[model samples]
Target: MSDKRADSVAFVRETFIPEQPAPSTATGAVKWLQDNLFPTWANGLLTIVSLYVIYLIVTATTPWLVNGLWNTESLAACREVLDGATGACFSVLTERWNQLLFGFKYPPDQYWRPTLAFVLMFVALAPVLFFDLPRKLLIVTGLFPFVSYWLIWGGTIFTPVVALLGFVAGYFVYARFVKGSFAAGFFGGVAAAIVVWLIGGGFIPEGANDTALLQAVPSRDLGGFMLNMMLGITCVSLSVPLGIALALGRQSNLPLIKGMCVVFIEFIRGVPLITLLFVANVMLAYFFPPGSGVDLFLRVVIMITMFSAAYIAEVIRGGLAALPKGQYEAADSLGLDYPQAMRLIILPQALKISIPGIVNIAVGLFKDTTLVSIISLFDIIGMIRGPILASTDWNGVYWELFMFASVLFFVVCYGISQYSQWLERRLATDHR
Candidate 1:
């Protein structure tokens, strides 16, 4: 029986040939085209049809793009330059580039302040976005908010300094008490920050406002793409942490805490973003104490943050719900406390699961920033629909201005999408 089994065994080859390239007909771009684009008769036919459609589009658009008038002052000049040929009137973009970017009302001399902040935003975001970068660089990320606020708003440096001190005090208090109780520490930290801010307000000098600073720009002066950028960045940043807190609260054992979170989320989610924005624009002032002077930008931020936080909390809840019971059991088995287990084990996994949903919300929120134009804020859409199009020079040239806005938005939204994809790939640990 052993001899017969040995006789039935497959023979192993003693030596193998070195690797070789595929045949010319079955390799490179030619092979890829054959395999993917024209593997079958039907596929080949579809490929040909699609190629022809692309050709038609490119041909039809080519003349307009090729003959685009960039230097001319107005639509009339662009038409005169084009004469009888098809051409794009892009002169509006060139002439109002500063207004399209910095808002027509923004001080031209102080353009460098916002411009510098805009450039530095990417630097500030780098360490946070790409964690593989040096951890020490997070100091720059931490300081960016105060710095950005100082630059864009041109307030007395003392205001931001006071704000930073409040945060620093909060952190120290939270660290001291967090080991004992999360709720106690959190509320304590918040109270500490408020106390610091209130006290610090007393020390700031009245004369300190205009001195040692760039000219202060009102929130009303902020417009065009800059407003959109500001709103999107601030809201996205604020919503995530608030969302996490809400999600945790919703899942808590305490009835009061859970009920409060549930009610807040439900109320916010039930309301349309446009309604919230309208309130921010006109109605929210009535809710504040009499004689209070809340900036439109601050009101808008609060509304958008609340709106986004509710949705983000729901997304995070779904992530938490998707986790296996065993995950919680394993954390408990390790003898870790609730916060430690959540921070170390559960949330990392849940957040990974929730990333796509979170990013989708973020992108949608950014696009929704354009809706602020309905309230008379001159964002990119507002700028186009108001200042740019209303001008006699660009009155009838709709396509070029709208197309520029579309391209700018597409570039930003597309970049965000690409970053999310890269982040997903980076965090993937399944080995597949």
Candidate 2:
């Protein structure tokens, strides 16, 4: 049997062939078009119709953009230049670009301050957003709020220093008691911060700001896209932690905590955000002690933060509620305390589930910053509606100005959307 098998003809190649490119019919551009565009008769028809529609849109709009009047001084100049041609007067944006970005009232000399803050924000956010970046960069992240506030507000060095000190004190207090009890650490940290702020308020010289390197810019003077970015970023950053706290509180066994969280969430959710903003603008002052002199900027920040936190909490709650009961039972079985269980296991999973909802709410909140215009605060829309459009030179140039605003907002919202998608892909462990 062995002799007969050995003698039988069986082909074996001596050299292994290198891999070659797939056939034209099976790969690359041709294959993709065949599969996606002409997979069936109906798909082919749809593809043709879609292409026709795209062509129609481009044909109708391309001349308006291509013939845009970009170098003119005003709408009048733009109209003269266009001379009946289908075109956009992008000149309004060019003429008043600084006012659109930094507001009309912001000192021209100090324009770099907010601009620097905006650029630095990307640096601070890099580690938080990408996570693969150096963890040490988070120190820059931690100091960013204080540094940015000083830069934009141009306040006494002592004021931001005191604020930073309060946070430092809070962190130290939290570190001291966190291992013993989370509640003790949390409440203790808050108390420590408040005490530091209260005490430090008296020591800073009032004149420290006058002779300071950068002159203070009053809150009333803040306007344009800068104000919108400030509100959106601050509220979003603040609300995430508050939202998480409210979500946990809602899930608490403690009757008092659960009841409080439920009441806050339900009441806030019941009211429209515009109503809250109105209160923050007009009515909140009545509730404060007489002559308290609270800044309008501070009030608006509080209201926006609370409004977003309520929505975010509900989003996070949905995430938490979707988890299987077995997860909770397993944490209990492992002798994990509530805080440990939530922080170490439950929250990471729940937050991942909530990412889409959270991003949606964030996009909404950023857009809603326009509502500040109704209250007489000049954000991007306010700048357009009030200053640029109402002005003699740029009056009637609505399309270009609004279109610019739209593009700016779209860029930010789309970036958030794309980042969320990237994050989802990164966190996917099922390899699906």
Candidate 3:
């Protein structure tokens, strides 16, 4: 009985002690530090280097952000604040905010038009970026010009009337006859648009002489950032379907069709954009009848569209090539015609796969719209340049204006890139 009692006591002692938790080879903050910061000689060195770099950045940035003289109200105040030491003149940005946001030439009463258009653009773009918007809603959203024109140029009914005709004609052609084949739909819409324009007497505004209707409202050079957007959108919207056709042609079995596509793509790609723009400006008039005169802005739009389409064709060709051979073979096996197979199966998949790449190209094209400033168009950057040079009170404001514009562009491009990433991920899942 005593022996049994001793064994019971031993069992209790062993169970209660719990083996001292096996000494826990790594635990607490010390272990974490050792693992992360000093796991090896290389890791320890990297940790020390990273800390030093961070210290340098903080020491440099803290002074500039908080105690710099450039944050002062004026150059004189800046000099007094920092005792003539160096720093960024961020105050200049706040001082000329109005001129930068709205050109000094713009009337204050009309500022509301641009402001409202800006807000609407953001609202329209938000759903396009973040949500899986219905196709119908997308079509409506794309008609921003109609709403914006009513707000901006309230006195002129021509803009909204044209927009309505375009929307109606596009819907009729695509929804009814063409059944959403982009090539057929686009051509059909164009034909219908011409008919609408003729029937609605668009070429003859009521009570207006031919000369008055033909007169330019504003100089091509006076067009602002909004004008740049309009040009880009108009050009790209026209070119996309054309680009797809070129891509398909380049991939065609017919030698003549493929050769034509190849020549067109190569010829456009080989030339500089500036040369093309110059041609549009100087030589496009010769192409039309002797008495006919083309609008300069329209000419520029045409050239840019053609140039952009060539690049888009190459991008889409890459997408087409990436598609599996089995897809083409299966379509053939199902007795589908080339156009039917491509429209129903291949193109949908290919376009979905190419979304991210296409968005990247679009962002590039958007940024390149600034190049219009070189042709004397007063895009935002051009307007800013004039003010910086002209304003005696705001001399040397280049950095401030440029930085602000850069930030705006970065935000827009970054948003587009992020949206593309999301679309790619969503499409990847759908394919699976």
The TM-score of predicted model 2 comes to 0.90
- By TM-score, the candidates rank as 1, 2, 3
Q: For candidate 3, give the lDDT of residue 183.
A: 49
| TM-score on alpha carbons, each prediction | 0.90, 0.90, 0.75
Tens digits of lDDT, candidate 2, 150-227: 999996889889989999999899888866655557668878997898799789986887788888998989999899
- When superposed on Cα atoms, how far off is each prediction in RMSD? 4.6, 3.2, 5.5
Q: Name every residue pair that clashes in candidate 2.
A: none
User: Would you list the clashing residue pairs of candidate 3?
Assistant: none
Point out the worst 10-residue segment of candidate 2 by lDDT.
Answer: 178-187
Q: Residue-wise lDDT of candidate 3 within 116-228, one digit each (tens)?
A: 87788766665556666665666657677677655644434564677588668866886565543444565577678767765665464554533332222433423556665
Cα lDDT tens digits, model 1, 1-432, are 999999999999999998998898799999999999999999999999999999999999898888898899888898888888998988888899999898999999989988899999999999999998999999999999999999999868998999899989988998788676565566678789978987997799987766855677889999989999999999999999889878988998889878999999999999999999999999999887677577899999999999999999999999999888999999999998887888899899889989899999999999999999999899989999998888888899888888888898899999999999988888992324
